[model samples]
Target: MLRSLHLRAISPEAKKVGLAAFLSATAFAAVLGITAPAQAPVERSVAAPAAASPDSVELQLLGVNDLHGRLESPKAVRRETGGAPVDIGGVAALDAHLDRAERSHPGRTIRVHAGDMVGASPLLSSRFHDEPTVRAMNLMDFDVGTLGNHEFDEGGRELTRLLRGGQRSDGGQFKRDAAGRKANTSAPDFEGVDFPYIAANTVDREGRLGLPPTRVIERAGVKVGFIGVTTTATPNHVLDEYTERFEWLDISDTVNRQASELRRRGVEAIVVLAHSGAYDVNGDPGAAAGEIIDEAREMTGAVDVVIAGHTHSRLNTRVANSDGLGDKLVVEANSYGAAFDRVRLTLDLRSGDVTAKSADTPTTWNDEVAPDPAVAALVARYRAALGGMGERTVGRLAEGLERAGSLSEVAARAQRRLANADVAFVEGGNSRGSLAEGMVTYDELFEASSYEHQVMRMEMTGAGVRRVLEQQWEAEPDAPLHVAGPDEAALDDDATYVVAANALLMDQDQFTAFREYGRGVRPVGTDLEALEGWISSRGRETGVGG
Candidate 1:
């Protein structure tokens, strides 16, 4: 039988140790295709139904979070019944899952996305400004969603255009044909989002919500209110310019206020679709904790369920609301469209209140489910538009390189070579993934350095460089800045040196030292092109793996 692990929040040290153990245990279960003998089922309390009768309604909530424009299936691991590593998470696979659920529940099901639907996407979708993803979501019939930090990557203006389609900010039109070629038309048609995007806590300069604060869906005489909220720390994650016009209100305050409004409107069964989540170490959702937990506890009597994302952690557990409205279900599906939260809510139709709810996260394994034909066709079109560039082999790696190690080194080398600077620096987070062994494709390389950052050359004193390196530790104690072309033994504190970095590192206020110390900043090439050129130029000489 499939068994669940009990997850609970532990100290950072304990987390690191526990994470290893958890991975090992899950991997063993996956490899054997059986539950570990020592593993125990997660315990959860189910509330008694509120006077069951013909008036009661059952609502099935199917939702995904942090898809990040994964139109294609990425690599994933499954442990439910000891499955081998599987290719998981494509729009088509997600569609299949949704299809099965909807067919089972029929009209009683509502498909919702938590957030991070776009931004930091693969080239296939990002190249088209994530229009393909929006189109895909529409095809999937997503009911509603909120925003995540990545949604603000390009700023509110672009976000507005995404929701209410029109010409891009630059007034350029780009409409692709079936073959993925841009049509020879002056104006490209862009379809706006069919479903509403709720942002209860995200307000404009005038302190008014830019989108609907909440949405009420009534079905079978039952009313359910969904309050959408993004993380309050959105500004810290996104470029300052993108968020200058907006304000992120307190999550708890916003949810409570919106819940009150929803209640006053004679709607109960309140759910908060928050783009923030707690970390679940085990299967116990309550055991996982984060900023969302405090926010959920604060909602107490107002909120019944919380569907969370952002942390990209799996959580299918419950937490008691401090205000004493019974236990509230909180859940998060792992990111990249790898999985989705399946929640069933039993509601009292007369009171329009949720009597009980249960949730679980199931992996969207591509091999197990046939692709949805329509979504598959849509993805194929976009893939063709990419023109096989992503698949072009750049070079070969003798061995796989971890994101922090070889990937970082390769990026630093590329910047140094492109800018001819004495020192090159790359933030750890900037390198998104690892480099696998064997033939590396442009797409694979792009995955490692996905951002469209422009190579920037700046002159900084050695002291400034050290300060910048030190800053990495200030924010993330464990993640140190990756540097190339700098020799500590030969370094001079007062000496001035040319440095190469991405524009994000140069302009962001958080890297004040880099900004203040940088001189003669100029863009050379995009990070993607530079990495590609660098790898291609290497041409298997010296081998990247070595």
Candidate 2:
């Protein structure tokens, strides 16, 4: 018998508003049925449908961000979730969840994603140019998705192909288009997704072509509008070359304009899917919720809800809109399908504006719900297709290595080899998991360096380097892993040394590279790139559990 956990459910009023926001025509289906799985079906709790009245509508937004190529369940993760864990993500499971939500709620539910759906994909997708991941997303019923930085990793044209859906070099897994007509097997999965890819902030320099300004979904009888905006700070953190063709706009301004237009069109509700982080003026998590409200208060009339990402935060705060008409909910689901944000907004059927709301993060307990057999079957197919590649060993370790504590040592060794500095340093958190004294495969390497990191070398002064070390060891002993700046200037701003880091970590404003160094900074080299080249040149051989 499959059991289900009762996650969070919204008030009936909120569902009405949510449904009102999505429906464009006067058609609605209110079929009362089980919204979630039965009790104790699996380890993780499946999300339940929002309860609502006949006049009220239910809109369920299923969001996922930063799923960086975790196509298979790692041994460690599998253990963490429990042996029969609910297999939280994967494309098929996502489909089951979607189908269950819609079926239970009938006409009120709609699916929407936050972003980071592609790029950094595993062998299955990356080997094929990340099209598989997009294909799976389309089948899973992604109504709309924003342009995450990874989507641009391959640049504009490639991303356009992915969105447009086309052929691949080595044929494809299936031969069907969105219209259910036989097509090329190599085609991507953008079929049947009639929704637009929105990026209100991303613009071509000439302003003629850019990501669709916004995507509108008409559900039930209400017209719901969604404006997608990724972080403008993206360029500051990501490789700028990929995004250079477009100009990232300000969230507040673009969303305000789009919301006004939506309201003008009789859209009952407005939502902003902002791939930006919530920060205080000082750029710290401790920043008050009021500070975030103020930062976004400009959209009182234009937008009703804001869904944030990038910081990988879980926000469930409610604040009154600048208009004081009602509260605007700011929500976010943590990455890796770990959880989801359920925001219920009550809309005045006559005014088409939100009246009341409540929001919360519903933890997805994989154990509580059964892994949809169809999804599990798809995973099996992909796993079988990959055949042995998933577990093939890339190299063998000479000896057993410590799990968490030894990361600093491994990083130090790599840094000395590549940078040849007095001391090599890396964040303890970056090197997750221990290296077992056995065959290490591609999967193991990915697990160890799963952050999609790039190696960045820079010159740091002797003084600056010493300061960084002290900060790492002393400033936050309790939180020893997270490095912070010291109060006094113990190092010279001009002295320099060679330091290696990933491109993702090299960005200053986002990761504070400049702030960490007192002065004299220049690129040196990267460790991972060197490792990849060395391995490839050696024509590395892999093995099994031997």
Candidate 3:
């Protein structure tokens, strides 16, 4: 049996006058997936439908975001309402959940995502440029999606190809892995997404919108409008060259204009899928606070509901619009497909506006439900394609390396060697797992250096290098690494020396010192490759990381 752990639900009603402000709250019957007095969402199982009145049509949005290409189970767990441990989040489980929604609602259900469907993903998915994740979304029949900062990790050229289909970035077909076995050989053939990806605020070098600002689709005799906007802070999240050709516009202003245009086209029921999210300060959904709240509050009544992403926090409360009425329903499903928001919208036929709306966030519980076989098979094929790369021996550790303090030090040593620099400065939290003693596999090493950050070399004076170390304290004053390099005793202020760091750290705002005096900066290779090289050369023939 499959079950979804119900986390939160809130029903919102807006005033008929503005037809947009959340006027009051009412109790809504939300399907909690388990113990709901209805059928659980198992494979081939259908949920009970939301009843519709004569003058109204009921629709459902299976809102998902930040999947991050989790085709295989991430093996993560979350506490249920009463602090009981519950398994959650796998592509197959998510697929099964979507199937249940469609089986119940049929044509009335719309599968939608709010961006970050790919990028920064697991090895199985990221290995193939996230094609598997896109294929899964296509199989799940996602109707629409938007862009998150991760989408721009490689810049617009690659992003356009991912969205529209083209030759692989390496310009080679995924015919076989290194082991000479068939790989990613599924239907749809890595062509592109079956649905549309919208982004209103992202503009290209040619001074045109990157994607359609709004998409209107007819459902149950009512036309629902969707507006997609990327966060304005996206540039800071990605590399400079990739996003230099594009510009991020004002989020709230762009949404208001797009919503007004949608209204002109008779789309009174509008949903803004903003790639921006709120931060939940407390357990209460209403108590959440973030920039998205400010943006929603500034929005006009033309917008009814806002779906947020990016921060990956759970939000299911309504915030006040510019009219000083709590009329807007803002919701965000937790990231990595661990959970999703079931948005039930009721629209008035005559007014063409949403009369009532509510949301239920159900965590994907693998133990309670069977994995969708279709997606399960797809995952199997990809895992087979992953070959033995994951299990291949990378090196042997000298001892169990500690997290945080020790991990960065080891990675820093690798960076120094890979870039052939005098010192290597790496950020903490790069790897969530610690290296244990003895034989280390590529998977273990990859997990320790999973961000895929490129190693970069910078030419700087010894004085400038000291400034970089000082900058570390600015952020972590309590206990800073301080980083004593081999050349510390004989350091000269005016003499230039080569320094290395993760590329993101070199270019990010926090390390302005790194970008200021660093000259002849260039990427060496990926952080994982550096770690692998360093690890393999250190201990036995296999290596010395601790």
- Compare the candidates by TM-score and give the number of the best one: 1
Q: Kindly list the per-residue Cα lDDT of model 2 for residues 334-450, writing each as its tens digit.
A: 665565656655555556566556666655444435444323433444444444654755556555445466544454455444544434455554553456665566656545644
Q: 137-240 in candidate 1: lDDT tens per residue?
A: 87677778998988888877778878887657553345344354774322156676778899988888854336888898866668789999999978766767
Number of the top lDDT candidate: 1
Q: Which window of ten consecutive residues has the lowest lDDT sum in model 2?
A: 25-34
TM-score of each: 0.84, 0.67, 0.81
What C-alpha lDDT does candidate 1 achieve relative to the native structure?
Answer: 0.76
The backbone clash count of each candidate, in order, is 3, 37, 10
Residue 3's lDDT in candidate 2: 12
Model 3: worst 10 consecutive residues (lDDT sum): 23-32
User: lDDT of each model, Cα atoms only?
Assistant: 0.76, 0.54, 0.74
| Residue 300 in model 2: lDDT | 55
TM-score, model 3 to reference: 0.81
lDDT of 3 at 429: 46
Error of 1 at 72 (Å): 1.2
TM-score, cand. 2: 0.67
